[model samples]
Target: MRKQMIDSVSKVIAENENTSLFLVDIGVWGFRDVLKNYSERAINCGIFEDGMISIAAGMSLSGITPFIYGISPFILGRAYDQLKLDFCYQKLAGNFITTGAAYDFSKLGYSHYCPEDIELARTMPGLEFIAAGTPKEFEILFNSTWNDGNPTYYRLSNYCNKFDAKVAFGKAAVIKKGSKGVVIAVSTMLDSVIEACGDEDVTILYYTTLVPFDGITLRENLVNEKILLCEPHFEGALLPAIIDSVKDCAVKIKCVGVPRKINRNYGTKIEKDICFGLIDKDIRLEIRKFFNN
Candidate 1:
């Protein structure tokens, strides 16, 4: 997915002269060569995440569309004030493409993890959030919104789902239809949610673009009152949207996602998932509890 993002960045740079790429010395591995080829266009902004965001805001003001790429935790967590003030506060337009979704860098410890990015994004008004679960989806979403002149956040996950719903901006893909209940899978959690669901008579709604959530579709497909929301970020980050979508109905909503707390373990991302009870078996148990109760 990083490769796809780099390729997309290259394509956008080759096509548009006003576009620029900013990195805080993080994406050097995949983007080193590209940076060299377009040194003037792509810059390695060192480890100064807040300064990078301020610079991006300036560039945006000067008719340049900056695509800032960096680790999720630092870019968002470290420079949140810059993001909220420089970008969203000023209504400045730019693209924030981040890696290390949730616990993707689990072995690197808590400093590398960012489970609250979505919640932070939700606080910043006019900032659109798109969490791509696959290389193809990243390509599509990035191409479609790179130059939209809106403060957009693109989350590239290390993990991906096997299926592609040909996702679009601000739209949810209905993967399966059933009368039992509804399981809303956000970003990369679709595969596990599907696997955990097994052969249950339930509807699965896949979400790639989450900010401008397709509540209309969700409202139309509330086959049953039971709803299970599975995401890769902090639990209940997308809950308000669900509640708004089903405002008229008494829906039983359950969330399966990363807990909003510190993770001190070091291992693989899968191990982190196991620790959080976000694996298939645990999610299945949650699903059963949501339905049976």
Candidate 2:
């Protein structure tokens, strides 16, 4: 997936003279060779995450398409003030390419963990927050949003494409059809949701983009009103929006995800999944609870 994103972005930068890439000590090994191979186009901004956002914003204002790249926590979480003030405040467009979704690199400890990153991003305006669960979806997101006029976030998760489905960023895709209820899986949680619902009769909606969530697709899913939100991030990240979407309709909804409190849990992401009730059994339990109610 990283190769796909890098290759696509590199090709774009090579072709477009006005576009530039800003790197901040992340994915150096993955992209250093390819980007440095571009020479003048890629700027190794070092450890200054906030500074990079400002630089990207300034460049964007100057008619140069600047893309900020690096670790998820630093690029988005650390440089949030700059993001809010520079790009979002000015309503300028800059590409934010982030690696490591949530706990993709859990060995770095909880400080690097970012289940709440979207919670912070959700407060900002005019930013498109996207979590790509599959390689094809990642490629589509890059292709669709590369030079768009909105501040876009491309969160690269550890999970790849598990099943074949049409690729659309903000719009939800119904991978499986059912009549009992609907299971809305966010980002890479698609696999877990699939396994959990194998024995049950439920429709699975795979949503990639967080902001600018496709309301039209959502309305289509309203036929099966009961929704069980399955996400890898903190619970309630999408609850507010989900509630707002179905305000005029009668719908039963429940969100199953990590808690708002920081995860002091240890070991790998899967272990953390067990710690936070994101395992398949827990999700199945939640599904039963939501439908049986």
Candidate 3:
């Protein structure tokens, strides 16, 4: 997925001579070669995440479509002030390409873990938050934000899978159709929900875009079925939005994601999933419980 994102972005840069890609923390694993191969002007801002965002904002002010690449936590959490003040507040046209969403960086410990950035980004005016669950969706997001002439923040997960891009920019894609209930999975975690409920009597909605949610489609599909929202991040805005959107219906709603507990110690992604009761078995059990209720 990282290679695909780099290739797509590089292709865009190659086609457009006016655009430049600036990477933050290119010294990190999996990105060193991308930094070296791309002919476009790229910069390694060392470990100073906040300074990199500031510089990117300045570049945007000078009429450059700067792509600021970095880890999710560093890009969203470390440089939040710059993101809020310089980019979102100033309304600059910069694309924040953040890798490692949710537990994607669980192996790196709590310091690098980012589980609330999307929800945090929702509060920042003029900042768009996009999460891609599949390679095809990533392609659409890359193209949309890169060419849209607006400020955006994009989050990518290390886990890659094949999915239909029919509902790329809309509210969510209905992966499975059923009359009993509706399971809404957020981006990367959509595959898990499908695996948990194989051949079951339920509908699955894959939400690739967080902001600018498609309310009409969401309302049309969520009627008369129990709603379950599964995500990798902390359940703050996304879950509530689902409930609020379908408030007029007689549907029951629940959210599955990181628990409301601070991390005392960090472990692998699988370990974190187990700790938060988000594994396949647990997910299946939760679905069963939701229906049984």
**TM-scores, each model vs. reference:** 0.97, 0.94, 0.90
lDDT of 3 by residue, 1-293 (tens): 67668778767666665566766655345445545765446556577889878887888888877887788888888889999999888878888888878867776777777888877787787787888887778888778677676778888877764554565564578787877688888877876888887777888878877876665667777634688878888964586567667777776778888876667666677788788877678889988888656
Clash pairs for candidate 3 = none
The C-alpha RMSD of each candidate to the native structure, in angstroms, is 1.2, 1.6, 2.3
What lDDT does each candidate get? 0.89, 0.81, 0.76
Off by over 4 Å in 1: none
- Expressed as tens digits, the lDDT of each residue in 200-271 for candidate 1 is 889999999988889998988898798999989999999998998899999988888898888788989998
Clashing pairs in 2: none
Error of 3 at 292 (Å): 3.5
Residue 248, model 3, lDDT: 73
| Model 2 per-residue lDDT tens digits across residues 126-210 | 8898788877788888789878888998888775658645767678888887888889898888888998887787888888888
Score candidate 1 by lDDT.
0.89
Better of 2 and 3 by TM-score: 2
Per the 3 Å backbone cut-off, how many clashing residue pairs does candidate 2 have?
A: 0
